[model samples]
Target: MAARSSHLSLALLLVMAVGCAAQDYDFFYLVLQWPGSYCDTRQSCCYPKSGKPAADFGIHGLWPNRDDGSYPQNCNPDAAFDPSKVSDLLSELRANWPTLACPTNDGLRFWGHEWEKHGTCAANAFNEHGYFQTALRLRDQLNVLDALTSGGVSPDGGYYTLGQIKDAIKRGTGFEPYVECNRDESGNTQLYQLYFCVDTAGDRFIDCPVLPRGRACSNRIEFPAF
Candidate 1:
């Protein structure tokens, strides 16, 4: 009876360790938001405290996703956000990841949520500062606006075929992206978000799996003007 109890305790310890290890994510989903579509759909958009962001796709969040199309979030309960850790990268974050929510457009709150949820899951691979810096660097490399415009898919309230949008992004990043859209008041579907899959190291882009949910886009999508 004593030997069985000791073995049971060891087994329980191993199971707990495995559960904790599973919290580390396998890859990243770099999500970007189009301000034009966001504001148009929401019908109310405000900029960050700093000022209005440029008419471009902003970084929404860099989430950690698993192979099964699921993602780990809020992995570390004790992971309190420390703004000072990312102070050096604030300027770039403000420019690229501005909060577009209305009534109270606070970038800090957005960042805090992102860090606590997604960033904590990736803490094993990257510290707080590293997680944010990696996202900024990835965003700089993937210029969605330039890619679409250069491919004759300008954002002048014009509708572009889904093929054109995907082709342009693939041509720009050398990897296909996941396109999502939202509808405006006029009932027209507009480009909303773009997501690119990245490896666990956060160094290179990878082809994303078929998303678990259907994409929020029509065959034709409007890249609404901001």
Candidate 2:
């Protein structure tokens, strides 16, 4: 009887550990990247089987981060991303968050990686469906391409100051954004990714408690066409 009691206690501890692991973050970062800069570089990218993605930015992830700029990743091994859990959202995901990795696929691998590394860390606030749907909804809410275009910062391979880009996004979303840059083949710095801070609920954009430690962009950078 005593041995059975010991086993029960051990099981309870494991459950507590998993719970703690999942709830250990403060906020979410919805990161979106320009497919143009992704594919136009020396390191080429392949389009997903779902076909070419829109000219706009595609989701990189919705990462769980803390105010200190730290983050949690792969918190639950047992909570591997099951594609079936987000089956209903597959179509929408394919259009909006499609993968551009070499040797193209249906993009299950990209979503799976995000789930295990980031989504699992936020299990307290979201299950699989909730997590994925939240990303899609956030992307829908903040149309970066449209925002930039409306502000005359169109991605016609045009040059714009870093401040101009951030202001455009702020005007569109009612909150500022952090712009990340990457070099293309010619070594010219160009816009790469955009980061937005989401509430703990993953519902609305808020002023970032702390921006990510991303690479520096010049005062002027290109918004290259995809």
| Candidate closest to the true structure, highest TM-score | 2
lDDT of 1 by residue, 65-133 (tens): 887878788989898788899999999989998898876565888899999999998876799999899
lDDT of 2 at 93: 95
- Model 2 TM-score on a 0 to 1 scale: 0.90
lDDT of each: 0.86, 0.90
Per-residue error for 215 in candidate 1, Å, reads: 4.1
lDDT digits (tens) for residues 137-187 of candidate 2: 999999888888887798888899998998888887787888999988998
Off by over 4 Å in 1: 1-23, 210-215
lDDT of 2 at 188: 82
Question: Alpha carbon lDDT of residue 147, candidate 1?
Answer: 86
Error of 1 at 61 (Å): 0.6
Clashes of 1: 0
Model 1 worst lDDT window (10 residues)? 207-216
